[model samples]
Target chain A: MEIPNVADKWTSGVNEVTIGATKDKGGSRQKTITVGGSKCIPFMDFEGNPGHKPVIAMDVYDIPPDDWTETLTRPFADVINDPAQWAKKCVEQYGADLICLKLDGIHPDKGNKSAEDAVKTVKSILAAVGVPLIIWGCEHDEKDNEVMPKVSQAARGENCLLGIVSQDNYKTLTATCLADGHSIITMAPVDINIGKQINILVSEMDFPLNRIVMFQSTGALGYGLEYSYSIQERERLAALTGDKMMSMPVICDVGHEAWRSKEAKSNDNDVPQWGPREERGPMWETITATSLLQSGVDIIRMNHPRSVAAVKKCIDRLY
Target chain B: MISIGERINGMFKDVREAIKNKDPKAVQELAIKQTEAGASFLDVNVGTATADPAGAMKWLIEVIQDTVKTPIAIDSQKFDIIKAGLSVIKNEVLINSSKGDPEELDKYMPLAKEYNASLICLTMDKCGIPQDVERRMEIAMKIVEKAVEHEYELSKVYIDPVLFPINVDQKQPALMFDIFNQIKMISDPPPHRNVGLSNFSQGTKEKRLLARIFLTMGISYGLDAAVMDVLDKDLMDAAITAEIIMNQHVYSDSYLTACRK
Candidate 1:
């Protein structure tokens, strides 16, 4: 199809502000990473607005522990006990471009690691990991809201995902993220209407959209993946074809579902012969992540080092 | 008055001679030219009264799709022809029409759902073209309801209170305007309003100019999008004005010019 001349529909990004002005530019860092300033979708320059292509951020966590698989859990075993050390290994050894710290173990109920403990952990990880970091809260909304503010405040200017802002619990999360001066992940279930509504809500609050990434929640492979794929495709098609409001580049969190699903993470006493666990596991992830990428997923939160490697290789292939 | 560009169909001898000669370079050039000229949709009906209408419609649809990306409103009464044309196109589909016939709509409107197609519902029924806007809206509403029932957006369905001659009676133009306004009021975001743009100027010397004036007025209301000629520059110029004046386009909309160029 001939690309329409109406390519430059809108622009939603801006040049990032450096946290501490360096000596040369007023802050202390040897260099500053400026993220966000795209006028178009990832590579759709024909559409006029040349959107900035999203960069990959590898997942890390504070207080790592027990449930690690041999292939994955084994590789990071040395530093799994420390948040700071683990983040360094992820960036130095695993080719991570950015580090995402999932503060899973600090939730009130889950980790019971107080907001103070969470803050200390965030600061330590930031020092240990040179790359820009993204922070994700544990599953419980209340605990996340309680703890994220402190984390955001501690990491002020370092720039991180204000964990998650969901449909039901966005108000507090949004305010915390806004107050602390961090970008946010605008999460939505795999539905276009709901996805768009959340963005509108976030926009209403006047948050800069370029810093906001739309996470179309992942559904496990062979488990309504097609439905999710279709929605993402339609959303992308609508945006690219000229719905200005919906043209924001999309984010897909494949790792969350790849590990959550039985097929991608299970070893077997119950399921059928799905082949060797190692190949089967990463295969499920790589394929799911790749499928979403093809359907216009600009950013992906991935797990499984091997799958991340594979997904990165593929991303390089396309771009 | 929905003005279907009755120019591209192979049923017309010049079009057939141009198309059958494998002259896509020309077929496409002409279609895009018409689309730019002012065709709301370049109607590509490729059939004669005796031919297999479906096959011809599909064939012509393929050619036009290859030539340009503008939505082509299928001009045919036969359901299968409309369906065939609907299937082959990649852009939005604007079915020229189906009047008061429920059975025909049942067999065909679903094709719209299958393809995300739009339509121009001719306001004729078992009785015939209603002489008034109220009745025109009544039939247009039926089409709207059926379209909604089939999961199509009302905005996608253009209700044509099909225009008659202004000379036979100048009342028809007013009736069309009333139909345009009435359909505009059908809902909060009323269904898009349009007409066979040429219908208002039937047999009139100022046929082309009249179509533009009617279209310019249609824009004053909440009318969005239209179907018209792709071969006439004057009409195309009117379209640019309609879009700009209606606030549909912000500043520079030269694609409207490029479509003709």
Candidate 2:
């Protein structure tokens, strides 16, 4: 007898979420990116429709990072201080599908920039890039609540994806995003229940579930990567089995987590066995990203053009 | 969770009046409301009040299909009434249902396969409703075996262990649950299971509450679908919570809203 086909009997699928609004849809983005809606595990072509191919968003910060390693900083060295020009380079030169603007300047311990400054950064990036934008807040709850509302309004009609709303502090951002017509991300600390709870809380505030993405905290390779990998896989399985609360597209912070590792950031002089420091950092990011992609991540926020290029090429081949 | 919304039946006062007056508006509104409330399928029944049951069934199917694309469950005991509704439906449908008796299966099984529709087979036969768990399992296995012998996809056959009113026999609910667990293992890839959920609350003082509580318990034991009131907020909330607690769904603070979405 011929081998019987073995595939999952998926009852439901991930929610399809569109990030930017085009002019016809009452936003200024030249193109909108859609993700999720997969009825099978990522890139299992023979099983079912893979729905949308995964995309990458290159990260640009409102204030230049003073501590970035030489390998990570070299590609955007010229535009480091300007958020708008930095965003332009990510889209034009690096071929980013989307630009993720991080409001690091608004962090109290960092520059303590005002909401107005955050809004200014948003408008400048919007002017510079035509692709969809994901506007991320600095990871402090009180500060994010203080500044995200203004940033949400600044990008209101443009339909940016704004967030980092945690379990403790989703109210202000959730309400503002609903009113401003942008999607938001719900964050959890690698705990699946907490991840689901955050989604439920935001949904209770009446933000449509399809307009939300999920962010389970990332743990880099050699830095509890297995924890991140398992949680993402669990979330995807839950989605395929018809759990709407866990069905939103997932976004991972590859640059933020992978670079934090000593293995990825240390100098060759300090750890020569790991090879050249230049190739080591991007390789760490590339490896971490490729692992998550198999576990069903919809979008990855990456740094280092070299790692971004390699990951993008991998995505093209798989999809 | 394949929720079959049960409000469009002509037994309801509003639906009876709508059928008598030949008004499609009331029936159409129920179809849209139930779809919004997360009904995977809407049960359309021309109740006992209709003088021309087949005509009413056809009209109900047309009105519902015109308003929404959600699938319909042609819910009538009479094969002719089911045929009337099936002739006009443009989308996938569920023939709800057949008994385990050979004659009944012989008639409806082929029609179900011919229309490429799914079916709900009751765990009862020409001998009548099975009182014990053993008889219920026997009838359920008979339905599955017949479906398989006919080359029908077992997945398309839904086995209902046949819920009974708590007021009639308080012991029946426990027996029903035991039969449900047994019925699931009747075949290799067992047929999906559901209940006419409202049957458990018949003649009860707090009818909705009784039905809601029983359905939640049944879900914990692996019930896959139900024909129930989707519009009852409390009942729907209980269903969502039960699925979450069972880990069939991930827990969310606003799980109630998420399930509807």
Candidate 3:
């Protein structure tokens, strides 16, 4: 008996989006990175076009990350205090395709860093690294509304990927990104409907659809990962069937979510039966990222150079 | 959903007058209006209003093509008329349609291949429209087999179960729904299921309401395309909402606007 073929024929593909800018494109970066444009589900190259290989954006904080576990912080200990040095270490040593600058310190409870301080940090990081940047807001709506526009202006012609406007508070960042020539990230919380709804809300402001990226707030390995996984899978299916609202490239905060889990951050004494903290932490982060990759995520915001290396190896073999 | 706007057919008053007078205004307006109303393909039929249907089809195709870039479905029972319309088309086209009988497939399938047009095949053979689910399923399987033999891409083939008016044969709609579910199993990446949606509510007092309800039900049964009124807001809303509920489209507060966009 002969075997039958059961390959799916998809009508559409995820929209391709490029971040960063080179000199001719008006940014100082040496190169830019593009993601999305998959005609099939991830790694199903035999069936159709699995457009670009998934890329990684390593996280760098606006202020030193005092809360990160020792295992997570050891890799960048020498440059931990300087945002620019930390970003450079990520790019030169770790092989990150992009640098995601999280403005966590600007929040009132964090450091209450001024708009000028945030701009200075963004400029220094851009000066230190040649790769394109992802400038994420501090997530305090009022503070983000105040400081992100100035930071957006500081990188105006560089064409960075600026983030994370949800349905209720998209106007400020959206208008600023529009003026700065940056792609915007639209976020929803583990809900596919709101994921698409935020994209619609952002695009309604005359921001082009192709310039948008989607982030469904991530859930770590043992923390509602299935919810995140299923939603990502559904979004990919929707994109394959030509739903424009759900077709933007997806980004997940693997590093942030993975580290937040107790299994990843606990001290050796805290989880003695779970094995050494070194291997356990990186494995948790790596497994979270690599698992989500199967659901067609285009860019993963990761931490820990070890997990990044492991996930990169996995991607290399699969693609 | 692939909506084939049914307003351009000569059986309608405006289209009949447009065909007789060779007036491009009425036909072009409907073409533009239907395109705005989200018709994926405009169905062009020079129904018995003209003495020379082939010439009328050619003229209609030219005018509609000039107005909008939406694909045209060359709709006519006569092979010669469909051929005339195909000759002048400037973009992608669909042949709507050929009967499920092998002889009809032998004639129309080659033309569809040559023109690179999607083909809609009705599941009614020379014995006529099947009244029972079993007979319709048999004819539908034959159509799929013939399509495979011809090496036609199954994704481009649309299998229509041939809906009859609910008032005329109340049982046929239920039978057609069963065929809709079964047709999907005939192939991987199954041939798109379509219907002449207005046919289900013909001559009814509540024409729009019946058509909308039936269309919503058909969508749940895996019907992906239809030949219906794109100009009817309520019907279009129901189709969009059904697709969202099916998870085919991602939902938003302005989903109706988003789907059309």
Best by DockQ: 3
Q: By DockQ, highest first, what's the ranking?
A: 3, 2, 1
The ten-residue window of minimal lDDT in model 1 chain A covers A13-22
Clashing residue pairs found in predicted model 2: A200-B254
DockQ of 2: 0.56
Better of 2 and 3 by TM-score: 3
Candidate 3 lDDT tens digits, B119-228: 99998987888888888888888888888899888888999989999999997887777788998888876899999999889999999999999999988988899999
Off by over 4 Å in 2: A21-30, A204-206, B5-40, B60-71, B90-92, B149-151, B166-172, B187-189, B201-213, B229-234
Task: Give one digit per residue, the lDDT tens place, for model 1 in A102-192.
Answer: 8878766556788888888888877776666778888588788788888878877655666578777788878777776677777777767
Candidate 3, which CAPRI tier?
medium
Against the true structure, candidate 2 reaches a TM-score of 0.88
Mind giving the per-residue lDDT tens digits that candidate 2 earns over B1-261? Answer: 789999999889999999999888899899999998889999998889878999999988988999999999999999999988899989989999998887799898999998999999998887899888888888887888789778888888999988888898888898877776876777767788889988788788999989888888988887879999999878888888888788877765666666777
Any residue pairs clashing in model 3, and if so which? none
State each model's CA lDDT, in order: 0.67, 0.89, 0.92
- lDDT (10s digit) by residue, model 2, range A110-220: 999999999998998888889999999998889999999998888888778888898888999999999999999999988888898898888888899999999998888
